[model samples]
Target chain A: MELASSNYIETIGFIAAFLTTAAFLPQVFKTWKTKDVSGLSFSMLLMFFVGVFLWLVYGYYKESPSMIMANTITLGSAFLLIYFKITYRKK
Target chain B: MELASSNYIETIGFIAAFLTTAAFLPQVFKTWKTKDVSGLSFSMLLMFFVGVFLWLVYGYYKESPSMIMANTITLGSAFLLIYFKITYRKK
Candidate 1:
């Protein structure tokens, strides 16, 4: 729980968190580049979009910068996907 | 920001969240049933597992039960996938 540890191993979790999370950067980048979300899962994105929004609010309530920052980026990317989802919806 | 309003639309976010997230249940059940995760993405899981773990801690720090419960379940499911990833290592 003491992720604040000063040791290198202590930072592994943070590194893991960052690395794993940054993995989404590619998806975000590609999505931004193409603005194509036909392959993305609408149901999945819709669900997590709200979940992340709630978490963003929760983070605000708690005043945790780490949570706030991550969730914000997550929200942005998720919203983009959701927007594309709505845009490309079948008429 | 007012998720506690108790209106159906207010609850839509929660329901959307539950449904979209629960969408993973089928994959979890399938993986559990067959113990086959070859189709799952290891890099994706690893990235998400650590991300979810950090989120859990962040949720705990914030004393938000909603965040805690959801992230805990996500972490558990992600860990299972991670286990499968390590287990099925190409040795």
Candidate 2:
């Protein structure tokens, strides 16, 4: 009973983190198709990327399976955002 | 040595998670002030909010402090996004 309850909790966290991290997909796809990051804020993307890197480090240190798993996806997504920022950034 | 290594790893993950999770603050602040989620995608936010809830549940079940902490912040930020979405959604 206890183990099942514990597993449920972990599963829920994974699902939540996974969904949000994956949420960037549409934006990334849009940006890729449109090649327009004019609507996207460079500062925010920059900060987000940095933050993901920190999370990756944190996850590594903490040895958290879910955190690492979620952040890995986040880092990849954020990287795409960075690419879009650089590719489409306005002068 | 092993303990220190483990500790360092966890700390890095925490820092990373903390920074990235907080990265949404500026956007949240901006959206709150400007009431603009026009550029933000609705489906994405919906997915994100749902995901965070799952993560919260996961964290609760697993009893992981850092995951819980990070997800809590994420949930709040995502909530703000939801509010902005409803407030500024197009007619």
Candidate 3:
């Protein structure tokens, strides 16, 4: 019973991780394709990046595979958005 | 010794929760103020909202206070962003 419950929790974690991590892709793609960053907030992206990085660290300490994996991908996506925000900025 | 170590982990979790949850404020503020949905992606917001909501459920199952608190705040912010995206859409 305990094993089955634990498995259920892991499944939830996996799905949650997948959804949250994959969620950033569309923004990254839209930003990349449109190169329109007028609506993107620089401070939000910077703070999000830092926060995700810290989540990665926390996941490591907690030995949570899902958190580590999700945050790693999220960190990369956030970083790319930041880059695009800067690179595509209209001068 | 173990208690000290556990406290350290809790501290990290708290800070991580705070940063990740609070990080959404700037974007919310910017979008509300500028009414610019040009750079925002609808799919991303939708996906993120669902994902964050799932994370909240997972946190509930896991009984993690930090995760619950963080996701609750983030979910609200994500929802606001989505509302702004729809409300501010250029017709």
Candidate 4:
């Protein structure tokens, strides 16, 4: 019973991780397509990048596969946001 | 030793949680201040809301205080973003 319960919880974690991580993609895509980032904040991307990096480190230290995977994706998205902010800045 | 190690890991998680969750604030503040969201994707915010809500549920099921706190804060930020997007739409 305990094992089954743990598995269930893990499944929930994975689902949550996938959802949250994937959520950043549409913004990334829209930014690429529109080439507009006036609505996006640079400070937020920088802070988010650092935060995701910490989460990645936390995942590794804790040996959580889901956390690691989710954070990797999130980190990538955060980086892209930063890149977009820098490249798409209005002159 | 094992208990101490677990506590250390939890500390990391909390730190990661705090950073990741709080990272959204700058965007929220910027949006409110600028009243501009043309660069902010509506699809992303919609997806993010669902994801954060799921994370909150997962946190509750796992009894993770950090996750719960982080997701709750994130949810608020995500909601704010959504609200900003709706309110600041260009006519």
Off by over 4 Å in 1: A1-20, A29-39, A86-91, B1-40, B83-91
Q: Candidate 4, residues B1-91: lDDT per residue as tens digits?
A: 3433667766767887877777777778888999988767788788788878877876676666777888899899989999989999998
TM-score of chain A, every prediction, order shown = 0.66, 0.80, 0.89, 0.88
Query: Which interface RMSD does candidate 2 score?
Result: 3.0
Please state the error at residue A36 of candidate 2 in Å: 2.2
Model 4 pairs in collision: none
Give candidate 2 regions above 4 Å deviation.
Answer: A1-10, A61-64, B1-10
lDDT at residue A63 of model 1 (Cα atoms):
43
- Arranged by TM-score, best first: 3, 2, 4, 1
Docking class of 3: medium
Model 3 bad stretches (over 4 Å): A1-4, A89-91, B1-4, B86-91
What proportion of true contacts does candidate 3 retain?
0.65
RMSD per model, one decimal:
6.5, 3.0, 3.0, 3.1
Put the candidates in lDDT order, highest first.
3, 4, 2, 1
Consecutive 10-residue window with the lowest summed lDDT within model 4 chain B: B1-10
What docking tier does model 4 reach?
Answer: medium
